[model samples]
Target: MALSRDRMIEFLKRHDYDPNTLQSMETKEIQEAYQEVTKKLLGSYFHLTNDNKSIKTNSILLDMGELTEFKQKLKDCANDVITLIECLQEGYMKFDYSEVNDLLAIALKDMPMHKMQKISHIAYRSFQEILLSQIATALKGLPKEEFKVLEEFYEKRRNDTQFLHQTIDKLKDPATRQQILTMARVKLMVVKDFMPSNLYDVYRDYYNNVPQKLELVAKVRALTGLYSKEYLKEMPFEELETLYQDILKHNEQEEQDRKMFLKYSQAIQESVDNNDDEGFNEICYKAVTHLTQKQLSMLVEYMNGQNPFFLSKFESVVHEYKKKLHIKR
Candidate 1:
């Protein structure tokens, strides 16, 4: 039995594939192109991560926040299709929808596993937008001087709009859009690796200062049996000597823990710089135990740049770590 053009397009769209991409390929090549693009898209979906959290489920279940963002990205992705059609109608591309559809049907036969990969790249793009937004928010908390440095960094590259917007107004060719996206990802990865150091400095100060405030509260609570500052003036100090001593002991231990963490972080950086694999591994083991998703991303970027093969090693380590920690989607 021969497949109808309309039926083939329906199957592709139902499985979240971009049917319009067929227009870009020759009549005899649509099947090969569809198969290749679908495989690549599925692979991307399998590796999808948000803040170091792996998404391993076969289906996407988004929260309200994610749903809203996904809708916007889907809209943006759809605009590309509309723009392509408009350009083609305006004589930019010498093809129409009917011709492409007819060719795609003849090329694409019945294929199973289409429903299993229902999530489209457009949805994944939205997820990426959320991840990027989180990264930007993390970077925004840098100290004023460091933030100024980032601002200057952006200012330096402000005029380079070659890959800034993915809209059709700038990129008329679908192939060029794909090529630019590939290059942009590499630059984004490098930026992800470098920008976190400034944020880490600010976070380190926060981690150090918070314990001081906690210590002060502990001291006040010990002496006056009061946890609020408003009651400090009215407290009768009978010198609760034992209580004061206990508070001091606890604060000392807390300070020691902070110092240990600082030492470990320093060791990781030194290990990377000096090419000390064992030392880096030791510190990374300790650091990964407490690292947030943002920190893990930065570390991956750092390691990947140090050695081309390190990205796979780091990913394997993280996979094991996630399993050990029982971190699920």
Candidate 2:
């Protein structure tokens, strides 16, 4: 958090950071060192959002002085990635979360940590570059006004890459992953009205096809894998939807199902109390795997489509019974 020149100097000295010697190095070399410091203190898997939301796919920032130049830079970057994602999507679903994460990690090399990539799971690199490329492409498709509005945030955050790096390192557990999704949905709110029912189409086309959202999917998958052991390891949408639909049916006796549900609930509580969302997700995923298809399907549907209601009620239940469960530290 401390960005003071003196502090930076002291930090450098403590770690043998030679400044006069650094001056002799190429700008790229110095930049890399500065970035390394940010990465060490911050992290590699987060984004800086201006709205102060925890983990959302919002826009990149731009300083007042550099607004115009930053805007142009963004236009260029977006063009590059959108074209790339389009090519990538031609053969596979553009939703390959790991590949997207890889893109973002690469684009964020010089971003500072005033705010950082606040992800819960490991984010692959290259996600941001792909985003940058997408925006540029989208800019060509929309009216100038729409393009400006759509890209305003991207410009702001992209410019503040350094801060985003730092912001990412400070997040706590579930909050970390939830916030990124929150940010993305916020971005969607800007254009959700214009989006068609086939949201995936809109997502593939005009949307900034960055894996920002995929980070959450990946988190969910990781959590699911932890519990189920065999589930969600490499699941795509069709397979996931099928598996989730299967969770909705409950054919077993109420007592049997209830006991199984309780075990899963307790596991969730354990993870939350410990601030371990990944752990909670695994338990929940595994529990559903054992459920009759109908029961599993219902739960999965709620999770995928009605998350707010589910998460809110789940949080309430946890708080109400924390004492009874002896779950709090």
Candidate 3:
């Protein structure tokens, strides 16, 4: 598929290329320009150095076709980051990290150790401040004495090369390394609120098996909305385990609710097709009991184009149920 012109312009402008340059360029020229700019922006992550000789000797080399694929993978990550930032701004913190994880795995295929190290160094240098600032904002409510540990650790990681190397070396053990990666993936799947940079810190703490002040455990538990980070920091390990269990249970319930709603939606559609008002009313009644107000509203919206009569009946059922709940309260 062709890239959207506006998105191409935005991407070019982001990399300091003037949008006006495209005015004189044909579509093919614009596509080539976008590809060249993408490679220039993302090349450092895969290439050890810009010098051809050095890249050949020290980096995992990709042919032209492979490089095109690699660029798309990096572009996928860039797009995910943009979506994540927008969602964060809108107060929807949950995200599915699996797609990004798969993309990164492909993008990093055959990447040399030195290249990985270089990418880590670049991430630390270029992205760490933004990540730390975001973390500070999220954890601002915590006591200064407690928050200081997190602040100091990030500062040391950036400035103290020895400390950083020592920390990285701890992951050299194959079993420990696999365990850390596995834990990071599992946490990403379950926690659902972490940014990419946050996974870096998560891997470090997971390898050490030490509970840092802002470690995944605390972050995951805090996301439950049942506890503050301040409270979680002091909470017993057993209680933390309980909170983890609660999170799993809540996630399971949500999945079940989603499946139920989908089934009812399909049944409603079938009822509409058959012109069965009786079946439609019955389905709406049962759906209201199983689905939340928001879910019911979504169902109403979905029905609007399918059958206006059914949509009105579903709305009436929803209103009646809500009124009954209010009276019970």
Identify the candidate with maximal TM-score: 3
In order, the Cα lDDT scores of the candidates are 0.44, 0.45, 0.53
Superior by lDDT: candidate 1 or candidate 2? 2
Q: Which parts of model 2 have CA positions greater than 4 angstroms off? A: 1-234, 250-255, 259-329
Model 1, 1-329: lDDT tens digits are 32344544554565566767644545446444434544565345223211123223244443656434433433343335444233222221222224323322332223223421222223223433433343334345444433344333333332322112222222345454344344334223323343454433423323223444446546667654534643432222333334466667867766665565556546766776798877766666666776655555655665567668666755665676678678665
> Which residue runs of candidate 1 sit more than 4 Å off their true CA positions?
1-233, 236-250, 288-316, 322-329
Q: Tell me, what's the RMSD of every candidate? A: 32.7, 26.9, 26.0
1 or 2, which is superior by TM-score? 1
- Please state the error at residue 283 of candidate 1 in Å: 2.1
Task: Point out the higher-scoring one by lDDT: 2 or 3.
Answer: 3
- List candidate 3 segments past 4 Å from native: 1-239, 289-295, 305-309, 316-329
Q: lDDT (0-100) at residue 186 of candidate 1?
A: 29
Give candidate 1's whole-model lDDT: 0.44
Query: How well is each residue in 1-329 modelled by candidate 3, as lDDT tens digits?
Result: 34676766665676677668866667777767777765553343223111122111234443656445544645444435444233222211111133323444465565565654444444434444544465445434433432454455545554433333333444345564444343333334322332454433433333233455447466566557777666665554556667777788888777876777688889999987898978887898788787878677776676776776776677787788788889999
